[model samples]
Every structure is written in structure tokens, then in C-alpha cells.
Target chain A: MIQKKICMLGGFAVGKTSLVRRFVSNVFSDQYQTTIGVTVEKKCVTVASQEIMMVLWDLYGEDEFQHVRDLYLRGSSGYIVVMDGTRKDTLQTALALQQTAANTVGPVPFVSIINKADMRSEWEIDEHVIEQLRDRSWTVLFGSAKLGQGVDELFLNLATQMVQRPPLSNTHP
Target chain B: MSSDSGRSLPNSPTSEGFTSREEDWTQLRTLLLAPEQTQLDELRERLDHRMVHSQEVSQVLPEAIAIRGVGDQQLSNALTPYVENGFIAAVRKSPRAIVDAIAPIMGPAIRQAIARALQSMTQSLNRSLDESLSIRGLRWRLEAWRTGRPFAEVVLVHTLRYRVEQVFLIHRETGLLLHHVATDAAVVQDQHVISGMLTAIQDYVRDSFGASPDQTLDQVEVGEWTVWIEQGSQAYLACVIRGTPPASLREDVHDALAHIHALHANALADFAGDATPFKATQPYLESCLLAHYERPPKQGALKGWILIGLIVLGVVWWGWMAYQAQSRWSHLLDRLREEPGIVITQARSMWGDYHIEGLRDPLAKAPTALVIEAGLNPATVKMEWAPFYALDAPLVLARAQSILRPPESVQFHIEGGILVATGSASPDWAREAKRLAVLVPGISQYRDDGLVTASISALLDRINRTVIHFPSGSSTVEPSERVALDTVAAILRELDQLVSQSSQRVHLEVLGWTDATGPPARNLQLSQERAEAVVAVLREKRLDKAATVVLGSVRPLDQGGSNQESANQRVATLRATLTAQGQDSQTADP
Candidate 1:
């Protein structure tokens, strides 16, 4: 049994916490509950027929007042950068946190989950912006934590990346 | 020469104005004077932010509050609400996680409280047993028998019955407590830990035996206390019980779990550490704590009243029977009085039996036999009798006459079975006669003897003699002779049998005589004349034709008075015999 430490990073109200809650308990809430610091939860999933225990650290949302702490990003095996599909500026914030994680530790496996896909009619991130990130060989998933659509697939894709990638190449921040 | 002593002066362009130490200081000054300096600029920028971002401050706030309030009452009071809010928020995030951290302290507290409760219950049960066979226990036993329950179960209930201490509803998959409730005396300090422990035990059982996921731990006995669990589809119910509970309590647990699933299945499926929605199932879970009792009967029951009634009826029946026997005896006596020749002089009763004592005729019926015939106990009837011949009036009269030898003048007879007598007799004879008559057979009663005194017929019947004598030679009646003649006339006047109705059939005979001293012819003539004079006086006294005066020859006696009275010879003795006509009256007096 391999326990992989993972983190969820995104801007404020970008469905990072909702995404973890949906993947762990298969539940969604319309009411937004603000998280402080970090809350750690655990769930067991199988990737490539190997049982992996995913220890998820749900960090506080990054806004103008509170940004992601680099200490919380230490010792993480992989991470999922979440962005709200209704806002284009939240995608910029996810990209900045991705670069910070690469510099602070080293580049590990990661995914970008464009969350709130249930509100596709209100999506603000253009298709051209998504095509540019895809050309960089970065994996991306569009999903909704509220509707529980593609939420579990998004977590499983990240778990698969941690399993196939080269091991112990970066420093444990 | 000064340069040789200290080769300090540098051969730079402005060496005279700026030495090496002086040049280093001038460059630091130059750097300080620049518009944008890297190190100093960064220090000012870091200090400018005044802790407006609370990430670093928030990390130390809780620890600061705890250290400040360590020995200060006011500070602790001020921070109490915030601490409670923080704890609640932590619990809402992960209930199972919080319970796992604090289980060591909470577990001992719950176990000790339940131990105290069970100890007190056992002590009270022992006290009641020492107090004697309690009415409460006995009544419960009877009720248990009626309701088809076991005796030991009923006894336990009346003595120290089990109570439902606490109830909890838990999520089966996550082992998080959904809802919880407890009695006032319950000691469930932490409900989340108990729920987690119960789920852990269930999982242990299932995994150890490779059982199905639906398998659950139904009952767990910890000393005198028991924990009952019931598994549902999404969640399960657990109950903590103290003392002995009946076997039927499992049904209550099952019902509560079913209702919780029915009401909140959708909420639990989406439970993201928010247990508020499951609070609606609190009442349903609490209702699973089941307790039942039976009331004891009041006073004595219907069987006691029935026994008393039977005793009263028995006494009344015996009394009625005794009264009936006495009445039967009285009726028998009345019937005996009506029978002929059955003379009952005395009859009495004692103690519901009869005592009959009196005269009874030889021909009368036996009283004992009649009592037996009347369907009574003969031993209860006592009879005594004095025998007699008869008690009729005529028979009693004849018996009295034969027994008493009264004088001829006295008479005896009977009236209404009473003896009566009449006439006169001596006093001595009358008393002796009455005494003897009373004892005579068939003489039931004795009356008075009528005997008269001084009777003339009684005197005359005894006397039968008469006398007549004449003086010498007198033809007329002498003075003494006149009374003698008068008596002769009276005797002829009375006495009907002496003066016969059939021509002087009654008779009185008389003779005449004279003395010797005269010539025969003259003496004879004088005697004849005297006799004629007696006859002539009788004739003057009106003698009937049947009365007779006889004249006969004279007779003489020896001479004594000399020849002086030769007329003595002429005195005639005349005797008259009055007899019936034409009849010889030889011996008429008897």
C-alpha cells in the first residue's frame, strides 16, 4: 500500500475544497463553507490495479488577502491545481501556484482541474487559453464538484500520474 | 617616510581625499544615499504590512489564548465561548477524528458512571430481600405467570431492572456519529467514540470471519452492562443499557434503525462531515429505549371473598336445621293430645328435645314410637307414664262405690269423671270414705259427701214397743191412764205402714187383767165395763173399723188388801191389738 500525499490549489471560491469532498465522500454542497489553513482527509483508490491511499491536503483558497503557504505544499507527492470555469483570472492564479510549487520543491506529477463544469454556459476561460496549456504537455480535466460529474475521474487521473512518473527525483519540500 | 610606516594609503585616483577605510565607508554611504537600495528596501517593505495578513498570527492565536488563561479566571471566562466554537467547528469537520483523540479519558468516565449505577441497584435489591417477602415481588411474579413471562425476569424487574442509558445513530461507512441522546442519569461523555468503537467491533467480527459487509455485532455484554446494536442500510443504531434487560428489547433497536434509514438515507449518503441534518432522527432513536412494568393487585383477590362467603353460609344452614327439629317436636306433642284415650297430664321441652311425664292409659300410643315415626331422633325424646284402667264418668262412679264402705244412708255417684255422694253419716266415717274413694281405679276426681244431722225418721225406725194398765174395778179412765191412752192414740195417728191402707193391715196388739177379791159375777161385770170404757175412748179417738178392742174373762191374783176392796175384783184390764182386716199379725215389727 502506497500512501501518496496530494494537495489541492486554486484561487478563492474555485471549488478546490468541494472537489476533495466530492471525491472522498461522493457528496456535494451548494452552500460554500470557507476553510481556514488546511484540512487533511484520506481515501483509498486503486490505480493500475494497485491500492493507493491518497492523503489529500485541502489548502485555504488563494485570494488578495490570503495566498497559498509553501509549508503546506511540502512533502506532497502530487497536486491538482483547480480553477473556476466561470472566471479567467482564477486560471491565472492556478498557473502562478503551479510555478511556485515547481520552484519550491521540484516538478512532480500534477493536473489542472477546471472545476464548476456544470455551469458551462457561464465559462469565462476561453478555448484558446486551454489549447495553449494543453500544448505544454500538461494534463487538464474539466469537472463539476457540485454536480459530482468528472470529480472522481479528476482525482483518479492525478493518482495515475503519481504512480507512472519517476520516483524520488525532486527534493521533499 | 610616513608612507613607509603605514602602507595604508591606496594609490587610487582620489587617494588623497579617500583612503581604503575611508573609501569603504564612502561606498556604504553612497549605497545608503541611492534612491532604491535592495536590502534596506526589502526590510521596509516587510515591516510595512502591519500583520494585515493573519496567516502567521492565526497559527499562534490558539496557543496564546491557552497560555494567557492558564491561571487567570477572567481570561479563561473570556475565551470559553471561542474555545467552544472552535471545538464545535473541529467536530463538524471530522467527528470520528476528534473522538479518536479523546477516547482514553471519555471511556473511563462512562464505565465508572455505569458501575456506580449498577452497584446502587444491587444494594437496593439486597435491602428489599432482607426486608422480607416483598408484596411487590410476589405480585409481579403472579402477573408474570399470567402473561406467560419467566419468573426470574419478572423478579429482576421488580427488584433492579435495567434502564436504557443512551442511544446513538452512526454512519456505517465512516463510523461518524450522526445523532445522539441520553437519559438524565446517563454517563455517555462522548457519543462519537462510542459510535466509532461499536463500528470497529462490528468490522472486526465481519473481517475476522470473512463475513458479509452487512454483518453486525448484535449484543455486547461488558460486566453488568450491555450494548445493543442494530444495522441498517446506510447507518446503524447503538444503545447502552445498565442492569438486566428483557430479550424483547432487540426489536426496539431494529425499529429505530429502520426509521432512521427511512427518514435520512439521502442526507447520510451525501454526508460531508455535517451531521446537522441527522438531528431530526434524535426522537426516533431515543424512543428505542424500551421499559415495561406491571402493577400489583390491591388488597385481597376474589378467591378470598369466596372462601369467607362459604363459611357464613355453612353456619346459617346449621342454625336453620336446629330450629326445624325443635318445631317438629312441638307439632308432635299437639298431635298426641288429639288422640283418644291418650291422657297426657304433663309435657315439657329442654334443649330442642321433649320430656313427657304424666298418666297414660294402658291402651294409649307410646310417645317414643310416635317421635320415631315423625322422623325425629328417638334418643332426644324422653317419656314417663303411670298406668290407669279408665277415666269415664260412669266407670269412675262404680269404682268409687265399691272401694269406699260408707253407711247405708250415705250415697255416692259420678259427674264428668268426678265422684259425688249424698245423705248423712258420722264425721269419722265421711272423711275415711273420701280418702278411700280418691284412690279407687278410674276415679280421676273426688267430690263432697252430703250427710244430714237430727233426722226423725231415723229415730222412729229403731223403736217398736207400747204399754197399757188399768186401776181396779173402775169403769172410767184414771188420771194416769189418760196419758197412757193419749200415747196409744198418737201411735195410731202417725206411721203410715202401722196404720194400714188396706183396712188396718198395720197392727198393734194389747191385753187386759184384774185383781182377786170379789164375787165372780160382779168382778166379771166390772172388768167388762172397764174394757168397754177403753174401747169407748179408742172409739172417741176415731179408730177405723179395721181397729179391734177385745173383752175376755177376768183373772185373779192372791189377796193382799183383804176384803176392803171387793171392787178391786171388779177392775178390768183391757188390751187392744190393732191389726189388718182379716189377717193374723203374728210378728209385725222387724
Candidate 2:
């Protein structure tokens, strides 16, 4: 069995915890997020017939007043960056957090998710930005924590990438 | 270069031909640096072959290790695993060789351990046995019952010094549980989560307090439990202890953590989520699960002694009471045996009770009364007395007394079956006793010889004291003489009544005396006539228990010089005596 440490990073209220909670209910309560700025959840997924346990470190949403701690990204094998499609500012926050995670944990596997896809009619972020991110070789996908859409794929795609790609550095910083 | 040096260089471009100049220059270069080059080549070869370098490393390894060990613990930390693995392999390959190698050292240690164990076991056994029945133990049992805990647990709670209930060896980086060991009664939870929580809490404290990473949360106390955490390079050991843990306990935890890291260095360093390799670290974690209980107080033994003292006192008191009861029972049996009219056929004591079977005369002493007299409970003794006649003197006397129903004035006893009646009794009672004594079962005859009849003597005295006086020449009855004659007649009647009950009779005599002034023949005839006159008067009154006697001039009634004496001599005196009924009254007169 292989275990991968996955960090969930996003702007405040981007449904990062909501995405984890919708995918698997095995998560600490939201109160831990307020106190420790991180709540860990675990999910086991089979990628290429190999059972990979992904230990998810759901970090508190980054905002203007609070920034995600670099210490939490020490051992991340992969990460997921979430943004709210209704708020363009949240999309910018997700992009900035992705740079921080990449710099901290090195260029490992990651996926950018535009959450709240169920409210696509009210979405402010256009598909052109997601198309540009895909052209930059970044995996970008649409997800909705409310409708439970694309949450499983969002986690499993990262898990498959982590399992197939050999880490360039040690597992832990 | 000098000209001489130039001549020694054969490959110089000027000396040699142009074609061989390059080769000559090469030769000249080799000739100049050959020795130095050879030294450098040898040094490079020595560096290239690792075996020769290893030989040199081996020469300095032990000294380096010793020096590094003296400087710090890193050398020991690096070598502990190798030593442990080597030892384990050696023991696994030939346990006997290892055992034989350490025999001299292990033998005494094993004997000492066994001896100490035996001593400890014996002491504990003695203590438990002593306290099992003591008052303190009873109180502990009561506490156990009240609190719904085991008695041993209650005792342990009171005597506990310190107990490490659980030990957790957790990964420092991921906060995942590597291995865990706990005491038998400890409550185990999700060790992974617990380990994570412990790490998070420690991190929280560190982050909250702005403490350095080296400064860890070593201990966390909650109520009676203290979680002692010892940080290692790779993993940390956390033990939950109940009670005041000694200072050495921290050292032990530290040592256990260090030993686990030493033994499982790679496993801990490369730990992801698989904890299987860390399972072998259970013994090290288990070694941290220590418990110490103090010996119970000597007060338990003291309570046992007090209980023993009370028991001894109770037994002594019981024994004394039993002895007293036995003594009384024996005394009662002895008295029963000594009793005359009671014949003991069987007597025995069973279960602190007595049963006696005997033949007793109706007149014998009652056995129940004897039991009360012996100061014993009457209910404790059962008596069966059969009726029988006893020829013992007392019973015979009692029988006679019962049958004869003699008066209080008479005392009857049996002497050889002859019922003897002593003490004076009325003639009527005496006569009745004579009749009934012969009828008694043990009496052959009745003896009243010692018995005096009071009524017969009274009558004889009255009859003898009576007298009558006659005038000198008168032979007739006068009024005074008639009164005297009447008293004599009544006396004679009483005497006859007293003598009528037995084969006896009363005889009365009347004697007449004359004065000495007349002729003898005339006086004799007067005396005779006087006596006849008295008799004739008594006979006229029908008093037949009488005989007449005359004293004439041949006998003087009185020798007085006065004429009154003469008048007194003319009296007739009455005498009464007891004689056989057919005896002649005239011949018996005196």
C-alpha cells in the first residue's frame, strides 16, 4: 500500500473542506480549521490497481488577512487548488496559493478545481482562463461540492498522477 | 638550464633530430617527474581500491569509535543496532553457545532472581494470608463490594506507587502510530488518531507558546494520569502513567524511545503508513509499561494479631466453662453413687448433657434436687428412677416412720430389722407402733424397750401417794375418810384404764396401822377391822383393783411423842403397781 500526502489549498470559502466532506465524510469538524488552520482527512483510492492512501491536509482557506503556513506543505506529494467560479477574486487567490504550494513542496502533481459548478449560470470566471491554465500543462477541472460533481475525479486524478510519476525529491521536505 | 643539465637531457630539441624530438621531450618529461609521478599514482591507486582503504579504516575504527563515544552518544547510537542485531543473530544461530558463554554470569543472576522471586512470593503470600482474614482485609472487601471493584484492585489502588498504563511509539513527522503496547486493563482507543491528536496538541502548544522545536511538551497531566512523552530523533515515546511516577521513569521512557530508534532506525526514518515493521518494537514499548505496588502496611498484620488474640481469649473462656460444667457433672455423679437408696444402673454424659438411670426408693433423695444443688441446669440432666425397696438402715427407718406414722416424741430406727422405738411416747402410740412395726417390709420385730410410756407412770404415782386416816377406836367411815377413799377409787380406775391396752393389770394395796397405847391383841383386831372397813368402803364404791393389808401392835406406823402421831397411824395408804392380768393381787402386795 502506498500513502501520499495531499494538501488542499484555496481562497477562503472556496469549498475546499466542502469538496473533501462531499467526497468522504471521514474528516474532522470545521472547528479544527478555525483553530489549527488545518484538518487532516484520509481517503483510499486505487490507481492502476494499486491501493494508494491519500492523507489530505485540508488547510484553512487563504485570505487577505490570513495566509496558509508553509510549514503545512512540507510533506505533500500532491495538492489540489480550489476556487469559487462565482468570485473572480477567489480564482486569483487560488492561483496565488498554487504558486506558494509549488514553491514550498516543489513541482509535484496538482489539479486546479473551479468549485460551485452547479451555479455555472452565476459564475464570473470564464472558460478562457481555465483553457489557458490547461494550455500551461496544468490540470484544470470543474467541480461542485454542493452537487457532488467531479469531487471523486478531482482527488483520484491527483492520486493517479502521484502514483505514476516518480517523486524528484524525498517524500518529506 | 645549465649546459651540463642540457647534455643529460637526451630528448632536447637541439640535440636530437626533429622527428624524434617529441618522443625525446616526452622521455625527458617522464625522466624528470617519474619518481613524483609514481608516488602520485600509488596514492591514486590506494584511493581507487576500497579494500586497501578499508584496511586502513579498520586500523583506526575502534579508536575512532572509542573517541567518538567518549565525545558524545552518536557513536553508540550508530552502533547499538549493529550490536543488537549481532547479538540476536548469535542467539538465534546457537542459543546454547550464547547461554554457555554467559552461564557463569547468568547463573548467579538467575539464582538470585529466583531466590528473590521466591522470597517475594513467600512474603506476598504471607501478607495476603495474614490480611485475608484481618479487619483491614474485611474493610477492603467491603470497599470492593461497595465500589463494585475487585478486592485486588481495591488493594492495588491503596498500595500503588506508579503504573504506566499505556505506551505509544508514534511517528514524529506524520503523527501516525508506529506501534503501541498497554497494560492488560488499559482502555485502548484508535491509536493512530490518538497519536495524531497528541502530536497536534504538542504542535499547538509549540505554535501557541512560540516555543522552540527542541522544547517539546514533555508531560501532560489530566487528573490522576500523566502522559510522559520522550522525544527521539525519528520517533517519540508517550506513556500514560497513573500515580506519581518517579524521576527514573522518565529516564526509562527516554531509554526505551532511544532503543526503539536504534533498533528500527530505517523503519522509522522511512515510515509512510505501513506500521508492520515497527511491530517488533512492542517489547521496547512494553518495557515502558511498568507498574509498582508498595507492600501492604504492617497494620494488617497487627490487625491479624488482634483477631488471633480475641480468638484465643474466646477459646480460653469456652474451655473454662466446659471444665466447670464437667466438674459439676462429675460431682453430681459421685453424689448419686454415694447415695444409699439410689442404685445407679447407668450414667453417662453426651454432648454436654447427662443421662442417668437408677433404682431409687421412694424415700431417697431426688436426683433433680441434686442437680440443682450441684449448680447445674436441671434440663441438662435426664434422670430415670425406678421404684425399689432398700434394706439400708435409713430407708428402713424412713419406711417404718412412713408406715407407723409415729408421733414426734418417738424416734424409730431399724437395728438388724428390729424396729427400735426410742424417746417417750403415749402408751396408745407405743401400742400402735408395736403393731405396725412388725408389718413393715424390713422389720422382723418391734422393740419398744427403750421407749417409756408416759401415762402408765403417772397413774402409778397417783395411786401410791393416796392415803386415808382412821380414829383410834372407830372402825366406821367418816366424811374426810370418804373423800380420801373417793380419791383412791379414782386413782385405781385410771390405773386400770392405763393397763387395759396391753397384757398388764393395775393392783392396789390398802395398809392399816394402829397406835401403841393398847394391848397388842386388841390393837391387832382394831387394825384388822380398820383395814376391813377401808376395803368395805372401796368395795361399796365398786373399786376392785385393791388388796387389803393390816399392821397391828407388832408394827408401829410412827414413832412420835405426840397424840397427833397416834391419829396419823390410824390411816390407810394406797399403793398401785403393774402386774400380769392373772397375778394374785393379795400375793403381790408389799
Question: What number of clashing residue pairs does each candidate have, in the order they appear?
Answer: 15, 0
Candidate 2 lDDT over residue span B339-455, tens digit each: 888998998887788899989989988888889999989998989999998888898888888888775556777778888889766778778778778888778888899887767
By lDDT, the best candidate is: 2
Question: What TM-score does each of the candidates earn?
Answer: 0.26, 0.45
Candidate 1 local lDDT, B442-499, one digit each (tens): 6767767355432223322321233344555556777776776665564444433323
lDDT tens digits, residue span A82-170, model 2: 99999999978887888888888788899989998989999999988888888889899998887788999999899878766754444
Native interface contact recovery, model 2: 0.08
| Candidate 2 off by > 4 Å | A11-18, A21-38, A63-65, A85-89, A117-125, A132-137, A144-147, A171-173, B1-160, B263-277, B294-590
Model 2, CA-based lDDT: 0.76
Worst 10-residue lDDT window, candidate 1 chain B: B454-463
Candidate 2, DockQ to 2 decimals? 0.06
- Share of native interface contacts recovered by each model: 0.00, 0.08
